[model samples]
Structure formats: structure tokens, C-alpha cells
Target: MKRLSDHTDVQLTELFTLGDIDAFEEIYNRYWLKLYSAAYKRIKERATAQEIVQDFFTSFWINREQVKIQTSLQGYLFTSIKYLVLNYKRAQAVRNSYAEILLMVNNSFDNSTEENYNYKELLERVETEVNQLPPKCRNVFELSRKQYKTNKEIAQLMGISEKTVENHLTKALRYLRVNLNSLLLLTFLFLRR
Candidate 1:
């Protein structure tokens, strides 16, 4: 794994903007394993983590021209992947909670209003973040995260190249990282400083 450096994401984005593919490549090779590890640690699914990294990389390259990262590229990626894993965990928790609630409402006739309400509120907060995504990013994210659609599906649906779909997802996730929670978001955003 390439060692993490103090270099800011803004620098990398500027390099990419100037058509420096090698700079982008260094950023990619440097963080691919680290980011993959972050995702694996959270999701504990090898295939899913690998897919997440692969998707992020593809998206990064696709949007090289327009990609703008404000912090350490590594931190931005880790935070984004963390959000993805949290969203997945949140969805699973809701499903399990709902099942339990149904069983209780059916068997013991007691509704756990507090837990259910809290979970739903958190879920809504996350969903609101997703909804805030730009149109193409939102579409790509929904297709990949919700529909489990492949890049081909997203490309065909959006009538863009698979490469374009990849960029859309990458850029979208970057935006999410900045918006979801401002603590890490702020840390990353100010990474240039």
C-alpha cells in the first residue's frame, strides 16, 4: 500500500484537471488498498469491499477532468466508504428491526414505538443525504446501492458510457462525504490547509 501523505485532495484534483494521469494513478495506487481495507473492515464482505474499491477507482478515472476533491484523497475515500457501509448497516438494521416488531405485534401485541421511531429517524437522515445527490449521481447511486445494478445497467439506463456512469458515482460519493457529517467532512475539506 502506498503510504498516506499530507498532500491535499485539491492538489490531486488539480493535477488530474491538467491531464496528469500519472498523478491520478499515484493517488489511485496509493490509496486503493487502504480504502479497500476500510470498506472491508466495515462490511466484512470480501467481494463487496473489492467491488466498492473497484467502482470508486473506475469512477475516479472517468471523472478525472471534472473531479474535485477538497481534502486528503485518502480521507475523502475512507469517509465516503464509511458512509456507504453505515448506510448498508442502517438498512439491514431496519429490516431486522421491522421483522422483530412485526413478530411482536402479531404475537404479544406490543409495539416498540421508541426504537422503531429512532431507527426510522436516523434512516431518514441518511436518506435525505442520498436525496441531496445531484441527478446523475443519485441515479447511479440508487442503481448500484439499491438495485445492485452493474455498470452496464447504469450505462444503458443513463445512455452514457460505462465510464461516465463510473465518474458520476465517484463524484456523487465525494459530495456525500462532504455533506453527511461535517466533522470528518470539515477535516477533509480543510486538508489543503
Candidate 2:
């Protein structure tokens, strides 16, 4: 009696379709290495290539009855691996994009919420000076600097002349600049110790 290994590819296919385990085993033995090699050449990852080949065989066996071999089983399997590699790459690209976006969002959030302690203290000092301004001057400063409103927009909202808006902004900026310069000098002296 001839061994299943000696059978032709056509004979193995027929036997395998009829649920012959020995014929299936022979086909697996013949093609497993070739299939794994094809997968690895494309994916370049050992474990993932192994899994693709293993899954191909598992599906081929499970769907034997429904499988139509229009061409050789070898061709079918290599084609399957090509599609699997393409799909894996596509999935990885999508995941990488989402990871990048998430990283950008996290970095922006950190920059806003985790500012340097000394910088936060400097901002607090500026806020104290801003509160000491006359009410109209404080409102103008908050609108122009904090809310990012233009001089013309502040004049329109506050029912003041544009010149008055400009004067208030100039006064507020000059006061803050002088105070900030002195604070910076003090900070420099303290750090030198």
C-alpha cells in the first residue's frame, strides 16, 4: 500500500474533502513550512507569521467542504497570506494614527494644566496687579489680554471711545511691565543663592 505522502496533490485534495485525516495531515506536512516562509517574508515578524499560517490551515480544514480549489491549494494559501499581511498592515496603520492623535492631545493637556510652579506663581502676581486696576481699566485689560478681544471690539462693547480703550491698554501694560521687571530681578537674586 502506498503512503498518503506519495499521493498526487489532486488525490490529496479529494481525500481531504471527503474528511480523510491522513490526507489532510500529508497536505499540512507538505505546505506548512512554505506557507510560514511566505508569511514571514512579508510580515517580518516570527510569531505573527506563524499565527497566520496556523490560522490558514485551521480554516482550510474547518471549511474543507465549502472550499473550492479553482487552482492548486498552494496557490490558494499563498494568496491568503498576501491578503492577511495587507490586512495586518492596514490595521496597524490605523492604530498608530489613533495613538499619535492621543499623544498630541495628552501633551497639549499637560502643557495647559501642569505648568511650572514658578510660572504659576508669576501669573498669580500678575493677576493681583490686574485686580488693583480701576474697574474700567481692569475690564479693558481682561477683554484685550485674557479674552483676546481687539481694541475696537472692547471699545464697542464697553461704549467707550477707541482712544480711551487704547489709553487704558497702554496704562495697564506699562504697570504690568514695570512690576514684572522688578519681580524677575528679585527671582534672579533669590535663585543665585
* Tens-digit lDDT string for candidate 1 (32-91): 898888989888999978887887777777876766667666666787778766655654
Alpha-carbon shift of residue 189 in model 1 (angstroms): 55
Over the stretch 124-190, how does candidate 2's per-residue lDDT look in tens digits?
A: 8878988988999999988876787756578889999655876787677667667766876665465
Range of the 10 consecutive residues with the lowest summed lDDT in candidate 2: 105-114
Candidate lDDT values, in order: 0.67, 0.75
Which has the greatest TM-score?
2
Q: Model 2 clash pairs? A: none
TM-score of each: 0.45, 0.55
Instruction: Identify the leading candidate in terms of lDDT.
Output: 2
C-alpha RMSD of candidate 2: 22.5
Candidate 1 Cα misplacement greater than 4 A, ranges: 1-11, 90-193
